[model samples]
Target: MSLPQPVPPSWKDLGKSSSDLLGKDYHFHGAALEVKTQTPSNVAFKVAGSRDSKTDHIHADIEAKWTNKAHGLTFTQAWTTSNVLRNQIEVENQVAKGLKLDLATTLSPEKGHKTAIINSVYKQSGFHTRASLDVFKGPTFTADTVLGRDGFLIGAEAAYNVTEGNITRYAAALGYNAPEYAVTVHGLNNLKTFTASYYHRVSRDVEAGAKAVYDSKSTHGGVALEVGTKAQLDSSAFVKAKINNSGVVALGYTQTLRPGVKASFGVALDTQKLNDPSPVGPSHKVGVSFVFDS
Candidate 1:
């Protein structure tokens, strides 16, 4: 129950805050087609009967992006089978314009035949900032000691934005994980997380937000709070809603079926009470996307 930290846009002037802090030169490519169905009041790893199962899933993604005025790069590759996990590849890079550097990596052998790697580097000069980290190790057996026991993770995120509309943004991030990592082979491991968020913009096509999250695991330590709203229905239609940290509720929609095509749909409902509990389910997804520019 941890996913909330994306809500920052509310400009009151200065040509909408210099077109939202100048930076543009974009490229996009996309693909998605999905099918999912599940009904469970109780089900965990075999022995079925509470009746409900319909699964057929397919996913494909392709991305290429570039940002000028300094440095920015993005590359993505994704594939999915069904009942979770099929194939995956991810790549991310960001340079000085975003701070110092950023990196990400993931290779999946259908979820458990795993591979993961994460690296982050950041340094700032106005209000102070710093980050240096590493993650994920183990599995890919015998490719010369499988690159020496893989799973390892480290984290950092420091913040200070007393005023910038980029609006009064504040930040704090912490991370740690290592226990012969393969995400501890599904039982995850000694992990920790702390997050904070805020954004304000109550006009111009209405926008509102809120966030707070804390997680510590090796069994459980949880805290979650989220509030969201984003509306812009004229340039192409959009909507969002979220509620997490166990008392699940999510709704999403996006539409722009012309100038390069677009379509999206999302729905989720779950009322949590752990110990192999994630039922009382309702999940739906639909996506049709396309973007190409040269």
Candidate 2:
């Protein structure tokens, strides 16, 4: 069986900035705006700030990009400041017909700061593939004090086409880091996760699938199994629902508004027990979210 060709890269960028200036007592006392655009890739800037009776802060960023198809090279850099300064740079190359390599580095300048560097290379040929990786020290969280918590996360994923009508995907991941707050008083905490999913199209615009997920931490572990079916309602709308472990269920709906706009909303309800005790009222939350994408 032959797999479908990958989609070509598109030139696009998106970003959002918002601020709240009013205190909690006043409901309509903040300023906010969202901006998006696609133009010649050279440099772009955005600024957002708030100063009133409550608090004051400012944020700004600058980005640059350069892509050359003939040379098979791409470069990108971004710098931002809100409460702290951050800078990142990445370089990628199509080293061969079906091979690619990337090198990237990031630096944060502040009290007790540090930097991180990584190098990765990937090769693709038919259904078989290979990759190499290397990484250096960096901060574990955005708000760091001594940079002593630097660590690394490593993982890989692969997929294969069993035949013209079936495909499978599998992945494994691991990480090392400072003792989690939970185990800081108990001991060091570690985590590992594995997942696999399979899909087969019964007919055009229709499909059925199942997935399995396993997650383990220093303190607890759990497994979930899920299966579902999907069908297109029309050219503008569709719906999907799934049943998982312990009778938990999720439902989702999506609609296309225009040629370049779409929205999605979903809700999930679950009845599962926690492996450990909790101090909070409930172990879960029920809410709705609306998202816009173009």
TM per candidate comes to: 0.22, 0.50
lDDT of 2 by residue, 1-294 (tens): 555433221101000000000001111112222223334653333333322212334344544555665666666666656334444443345545545555555556555454444434332321223332223331111110111113322333433332332223344332323222100110111225544444445566665556555666525567767766566789987666666766755565666767645544444444464332542213322222222322
Against the true structure, whose TM-score is highest?
A: 2
Which residue pairs clash within candidate 1? Answer: 137-150, 137-151, 138-150, 138-151
lDDT of 1 by residue, 1-294 (tens): 634322121111112221221111111111233222222521111111111122332333322223232334333333333322222222223434434343444455445544443333332221223332223332111100011112222222222222331212222222222221111111111224444444345567755555555666425566566656566778887666666555755566667767544555544454353233434222422223332211
lDDT of 2: 0.39
- Model 2, residue 274: distance off in Å is 17
True-structure Cα RMSD, model 2: 15.4
Output the worst ten-in-a-row residue range by lDDT, candidate 1: 140-149
Best-fitting candidate, scored by lDDT:
2
TM-score of 2: 0.50
